[model samples]
Target: MLTLWCPSAASMESAKHAPVSPVLPSYEQEQHLHAFHACEQRHEAMARLLVVVWDEPGRCDLRAMTHVVTAHLRRHDTYHSWFEERGGAIVRHVLTDPTVIQMEPRTLGEVRAEDWQRHVMATPHPFAWDCFRFGILQHDRGFTCFASIDHLHADATVIAFLMAEIRSAYRAVLDGEGPLQLGPPGSYLDYCASQRQRAAAMTLADPEVKRWIAFLHRNGGRMPSFALPLGVLEDRYHAEYVHLDILDDAVMDAFESACHAAGARAIGGLLACAALTERGLAGRSRYSVVTPTTTRRSPKAFRTTGWCVGVVPIDFDVQQRAFPELALTAQRNFDERLSLAEVPIELVLELAAGLPTVGSVATGGVMLSFMDVNVPPLSAHIAREWHQANGRVYINQGIAAQVAIWLFRTPRGLSLTAAYPANETARASMHRYVKAFAGACRQAAEALMPTYSDAGREQ
Candidate 1:
């Protein structure tokens, strides 16, 4: 099992003193600008990815760990980059000078990782520079590495990449080999420039832009909200987090087989299950959601530590449909929607001025993210080297009206993590929803049992 850790006073102080030397030529991307403005407008804890790296007992040398972190900060462009508002627009700022964040590992003491996570998340990091926080916690049996980076700078994929690099670096340093000579990660700023160029060449008449406009139009020209009622009226309140082990390996294996038999992938099967649960709980026949997708199309960005992600709206009717049928439709819908996944909703809003909105509809809507961690960089080192049982992503722990669910498929099993508004009614509602979701998933797996059984008999 992975453990948690908190930062010492010295480490926090180091973050404060980290210097940033700004270089010229600023660039902007829709997603980054939207995240920056949202951070500017909200005082609450924003979404961040919290990662914990496990190590042998008492073997977590502070000196070696500091070297590892300093080396990572130097290699990733995002770590050396920040944002600033200039003449009413948020622009990127890069630090050319040496950027080093000291790592001082203190004992775990009495502080729980959850509480410390909230405290660190609540404590704002500087957007001008050093927007990420890192720490180490030493325990009797072992030590763990802890770090948090907001949505503006990092996502789950980026976190996975960085953690693998850190593990490799830390191991090397421990063996007295020092930092590895891995080349710099692909520049996120260059990716942003490409995004701007692609967006610039398009107009309102472009099919992708029109498709987004239609999606918004279908949802009252705003982002889709949670169909279930949230009892709170306040804008900000305490948030509740729920982790559900939805399926064991055996059941998940059967479910994946069922999905294959039905001509759908496991992701599609899972989406069908979620849609069924939504319909059962809220009596809604239509399931609509904004799912996040990565934009790292270039192989060079396979290790880039940037927020190169986009949100795609997926919706389908789930009325009187069987599990396999719904799963197939969901898969097709999800696959077909990727053509416009790279198109930013902010750009869509900009080009289509006639679209109605009370305020920014770019965020604060129901979102679902799914990832099979067995892919590429994550699979290469996650379980073997990192063993990160506690390395999870945290989003919108502050006030929120909608629920955001992250589904991660690991070697162990498929698990669901959700964040929702904290209220008695919301809490009860989410638990029921989770239960329904799990039930639907199991039933889907069971439904395919007969087909497999018949095949076995025929053989």
Candidate 2:
């Protein structure tokens, strides 16, 4: 089984000597997964939320939707599992409660979209017993569902699956005149168990994972220079973030085509953009970006909410290449790293002993994530609008990092959210950086031919 990276030496020894973990072998979990682990280790709630409004009154069985969703939740231990910080390593305790899944009813027109954002900020989602919540807001127009989820339990992909499952369950409810029978869920624990077995096969002594650890070890880890000076002073519990709507439909389509043309994934392309931006402003040519990817290898795993995310750090040395060339290189690197993305962060932590406890040191420098909400298009839902706020930290965890760039692709195109420390100077710098990022991407998309693009490339 893959060893859990314990924050304490005592826990490490316990994991080594103990015959069987409190939970299953996989129950030890991927608590060692880069920044993904922090959701469990830290005291903060680390709550993430989602707001969905289904305007269409077409055969929408609210009760059935809730029923099937709750049924689905019961299937995955990861969602129901409450992780407690025991001794040193985290222990997963899975408990099922019917009260936890009820989607409460709320007065619809009363709650604005921004209100949901403020609500999550003002009242942090506690990581105590129940880690997930659902509420239905009733309005004059349509019905909206608000979900407050603990990041400790689910990452982006898991969250996506949760939303998709709800929609699918609603469909199933509609399909079966009354009874919504969701055939048995392929056990998520089994997946984790398999991962543990695979991890055992690929021991820490495996040269590939070890090489990465040693390579990052030399640079004193992936800690980047924290955000520029500006914004809220009290880092913790106060969110300092900016959201940008970068592309409309036409441009977004071209951007995707450009990604295909340039042979780059969305995350890699963004990394290339950020890298080129940094090269000009900071005179730094290369950037190491920690990209979080979901390891949804099976269709069954994709159907449930669970933590199978990995931090795939891509080193972007695109100083000499044109945007298209950078894209091709980034795509190649993304694929290679993803193929071996299972390398445990615990191993890296064990090797880099004294490194500063900062935000995701294993793949630090900057975290760039691209999420295309993997659900049926929003048009399918009956709702006037939809709102989402992902990874908005109320209190800064005091990780010395340059910035975290999150890219979300909606039907409207790209929504870029940048989170950094609260500093006036840093805010100004972030503005410039974002402007540069947008400009770089636009130019890159137009200049698909590296041969011609290199001439106009930003030096």
Model number with the top TM-score: 1
- All candidates: CA RMSD in angstroms? 5.2, 9.0
Quick one: best lDDT, which candidate?
1
Clash totals, every prediction: 0, 20
Task: List, residue by residue over 224-258, the lDDT tens digit for candidate 1.
Answer: 76767667754435578888777776677888888
Candidate 2's C-alpha runs over 4 A off are 1-66, 96-127, 171-176, 179-184, 200-204, 223-238, 351-364, 373-402, 448-459
lDDT of 1 at 304: 85
| Candidate 2: tens digits of C-alpha lDDT, residues 221-291 | 54343323444343333236788776654565566677777777666677777778877677776665667
Clashes of 2: 20
Candidate 1's C-alpha lDDT? 0.68
lDDT (Cα, 0-100) at 311 in candidate 2: 68
Total residue pair clashes for candidate 1: 0
Candidate 1 Cα outliers beyond 4 Å, as residue runs = 1-43, 48-53, 98-119, 122-126, 181-184, 233-238, 356-360, 384-396, 450-459
Whole-model lDDT per candidate: 0.68, 0.54
- Residue 84 error for model 1, in Å? 2.0
